[model samples]
Target: MDKHRNLDCKDIEAITALLSKDGEALNYYKTNGAESVGHAFMIANLLHLHANVSEASLFYRHAFNLHGKSQTEYPLPQSLLQVSLLCLLKAGQPVPEEEIKELEKYAPSYANYIRGILIAWRGGDVKEAMSLIGNAFEGFHSGEEIDALYLEIALKYFPALTAPITDTSYSPIPRHLYMYWDKNPPKEIADNIKYHQELLGEDFTFFNQENAEEWLFEHFGSETLSLFQNTKHPAESADFLRLHVILNNGGWWLDADLRLKSLEQWEMLSRLPKNCRFFITEKFLIHNDFFGTVANDPILANALLTCYVNMLKHHGLYIPYKTGPGVFSRAVSRTVYSSFNHDAPLPSLAIGTAWEMFSIVEEFEVTYKSGGNWHTA
Candidate 1:
């Protein structure tokens, strides 16, 4: 397993298959020495990436327990503890009171962060939870591990603190689906596109590198087009492209590798309330990959402006913060928080649950594994 540390999606699929056979992986780890704690942590990450939240939580807990009993220090105890709690929360399982006490003992600030999430999860006061989370963020120094964790956790749980809207008068998102890829995509991505086209018929639009550039130039003119061209990676360019296309055309924007799980998921989309924008929140933050919106949505408008400013002002910033989920989540956080500050009605934004999002689409990510992953590039 150590040799397979750099596992790809195929490796993960294979391991998942092996683990599914009568809890073989779990039993093996139980019989093995505590030194396998690091391996358990790695396996937990793989499971989490593949959306096996329950199994990931179990493994994360196992790693946390094993690390406590071991002398090895590779998987920092604080990191393990944080991930364990987060995975448990994401899996919809109760974090044991003992674990909470443990977290409070070693990391009281993070304990407060978890408590804030628990309060929101348990339908407590929204303002109080927000205050606790905000204070937790202040306690962490910028660029620390906890800083990113705090941002992600706040983004995921903050919207839940807001009151639900009863109005439903906005226009429904267009049934159209838009996706993009390079001129020559891998067979897997191409097949995924074909599946969507078959499902959506004329409502599906596929954009390759050339056509996306053309569309950008046509809709946004040369300035935005140049910004698109200047992106350091295909994924970064995609971040710019999705915002512009959805802002102009108003439709579902799905990543090229995404495939709908079933027709039921399509029907679910149709049933979504006619909000100005619809987004799916994953484990930590609002994912940029799959979302829907009307043309010229203010949320997307803010996101686009943020991306542009990041590109021009903060050259060499990390991709996530520059043009990915980081900026998108911040846009959402701002919108929600600003509404509260002004005591105004919250925007008609619909956020799909992680369960709903996973039920709707699965990633057949072959290109990323074959060195085309922009994050790695």
Candidate 2:
């Protein structure tokens, strides 16, 4: 008999509610495999969230095993399988060759990434692992939570993966601050932009919805404008626009929600070597919220844009990634790789801050809170 078939609506509801109660849900699910494969998957997600890698892996294995007994669909099985490998990596265990090979049937592209990550993590090559993870997200596009989990797991093993750079060898890039919004800004966002503009003086440029669209059309013509209009995700368009504008006219690109902490922080970034591509690191992944480079760095940013354009075509302009940080990081990784072969010596990509240097003073309704609710505050 299929044990999971015995689960009732009440049992499913109870299992789901336990997710927010920490140890309660996981414990209940552990003792009650009859609770359903869905419950097992939920518990695995919770365990991953709490950074309980070993336990999460166990639950993920449980969920994966239930496939023969249950009716889970396509991508779910593939995602669970891939994340199990991540769980093993996070736990500091070498992923077995068989496990990587098994997942290859479901995701060939992902299989390659998992293999690369396995080698990198097992060999203690954190930098390569970081790049692989970033590139993986570019093609993956599952969910932000899964991406965060992957990043958290990598950071657990390599804490210095995003450590700050104190070297003063970098040149000063454009002093300009560039930000854009497709809609009217809230009071907090406007005030924050105003504050930065005041500090930066003539160097600040705040592009509103029309201004940004007009700038896109003016610079790239009707085809790019059509692409921007066709993309359903605001964040994707914002990300694409940011990189294009920065590549065309080099300067600082800060997310509207991210604010500079102080003048001293600005000064620190202002003094960096100008031509290098500077990014702010958060945990293991480079954040798209803050980064800058000198204008038109020997066709490097153009190459990055070309990569992104290709991604847009391949992914059909998806949200939270197709043109967002994942794509940005992937493009940077490719640029870095190409620079090695070419004598043009493309500007290097470096993490400028060890941790997130700016503060997100405003809260969005879409962002998840610790209490398992989306905060509108």
Candidate 3:
């Protein structure tokens, strides 16, 4: 609190009065310092007088930026004064900046700091802006102080923003994201994991993407990130699935029309090296009732990739087929079928079919398919 000892008595009084209420007090402590239990006494007095909120937000922004940039190793009164600024802004008021003699002229170096303030003060998005600042800070600073300050502020406001995680209906957390449950492994899956103990025993400290992004952040050596949030098809190419898989994890992605097939298929599929990869039928077989009229879906079958159908059922059949524009995870939305190109150019060899593999072979020499074995031609 000593850093803000220069604050006028009237400003102090306004802040003290606001902190009297439990909610406002929590807000102050949240924005202030971690060791702020008894400090709320001064804050309550500030709120009782209730200074203009808009003006206070400016000071809060300055204070946070200052604190973040400061070399001082300890939390100070400057933090509490800034907490006043945050409270005022949270109350839907404007925050005014006292023109500083130190930065009277805007320099490019100082421009970044000003940008942070403006980003934080963005209307209707004060909390999001603040959190984004904190999240972005991890990208720029390796310092413990800034991270600690961000953690303190985030601890207060994120619970409300994160309430959706508990309600699975609206949860954005991906199925593949390392959830908290995956760390210890549930007792049932624990046994299954134990069966594969030799596989995972390579000694990776698996951090739940949900519970331990912080821990993962600490491991600067680790470049691994979960990219399951967006499933929208890329307009760039049919090969985006392959690139997407490579970027997120590694090696090749099998654009599988996956099913709970017989164990024999699983053994064969599993036997393939992760590098060699595998794809299920390039064409998916779905209920004909939903897609078309009769038991024989020659049109939709042709709509499926000829290579996929040939791989699954018959090698020699008069068929035209096309591949979906992008491969989508079934764990994601079932938009895979919808993403298939209805207007994809028909090959001279096949008409009125989603002929993906043959088209790739005709166009990009980079992609190929397998006959009974690997099809290079």
Candidate 4:
């Protein structure tokens, strides 16, 4: 397997730097001192990684403009054009019929895969789309990682799959309040952490970046560390990591933006009947951002985390669904299925009233340049 398969933020940054420097590598099709198509493709890939779809499409278009649309003499040029078209289509932009007409002209074999995904996206049937894509690519065994991302995208668009839980059993309340940061968070985020720690008092252990990293390595080993680090989206990485923490160590997990309504509310939550193994906030559908579970909780520890880890390994990495709320939402819905459909109930599950467990105080003015929208205050 390729060493670059486990690409992390650090690796991405290094590749970007190399591509930027003069005489580094991959400067194909430069015209009259203008940026080369190869350079544009590299930039587009970076933007894609960051989930900046709008900007990525612009760069993709720029690359296509430098090279004629119908050229298939080289693999790199054809791949760039394919990605460019996909990005535009995925963004819900109007793709010229001419562009669609040219897909098979370039990569005849790969065009079917593209067509399958596009048809699925248009029809709004994620399952159908996945089936078509699987068939198109011969069961998706060779490019399993990319296939995983395709499944995640399908899940994000059409997310109606899940089962519900009637009740839950909670025993000992876990004292761990786990949180993580890719870097030192903003001042507001820092203040939010301090305030929550004070309210939770001595019982809770606030696992910051260092603490979280140390504990992750200690318990899960280096493989877990690489998996966590290789996650293309930091917010998704954090989301998946929290599930693992609760599964392994049992605890309450909260996004940084979430705040308690009052100290009394926390007291009440702490004293809730210790029967439910998993507690989640919900109005109608379950909110992915905040939740709680004890160590070795079967639903979270086994099913939910298992599903997430498998998806991550198989899919490699993706945005929106795979690394975002999509996976969490699917997991919650599956918990419902496990509770009702299975002859044996999966685990004790409870839904928390929104404001009582935590209040989402939306801070509109401050914006986060990175991470998920839920991470912003």
Q: Which candidate number has the best TM-score?
A: 2
lDDT of 3 by residue, 146-194 (tens): 3333333332333331122122131111112011222443354344334
lDDT of each: 0.69, 0.61, 0.29, 0.53
Residue 123's C-alpha lDDT in candidate 4? 61
TM-score of 3: 0.25
Candidate RMSDs in order: 9.9, 6.9, 22.4, 11.5
| Candidate 2 C-alpha lDDT tens digits along 1-377 | 23431224356554455354567555766566434567778777778888878657756766766665322573366677778777887898657777677777766656767765676656656555554554455455433333453554444443343455566764557778888767767676777779888877787898876787899899989877777776555666676688778888888888877777767667777666546544434543456667777777653464456535555565653444455665554544444434432434544444445434443222333221335431111
Clashes of each: 0, 6, 29, 15
Put the candidates in TM-score order, highest first. 2, 1, 4, 3
Compared with the true structure, what per-residue lDDT tens digits does model 4 show for residues 208-321?
556667877998898777767666556756766777777787767777766555665455545434433333333233454666676776555444553455565656434434
**C-alpha TM-score for every candidate:** 0.61, 0.66, 0.25, 0.49
Better of 1 and 2 by lDDT: 1
Poorly placed runs, candidate 4 (over 4 Å) = 1-171, 274-285, 303-317, 343-346, 353-365, 369-377
lDDT of 1 by residue, 1-377 (tens): 12221223235455455467435454554454224577778767766777667667666666766676432575666556766777777778777777767767766777777777777677777666665655454333222233344434444445543225454343477778899886788788888889888888898899988999899999889998899888898888888899999999888888887788876677667655655544545444667889888888888888888788878987677786778876676666667656655667767676656666777888765746565456623
Candidate 1 local distance difference test against the native = 0.69
Candidate 2 regions off by >4 Å? 1-43, 66-73, 76-79, 92-98, 104-172, 230-234, 261-268, 297-318, 335-347, 356-377
- Estimate the overall C-alpha local distance difference test score of candidate 3: 0.29
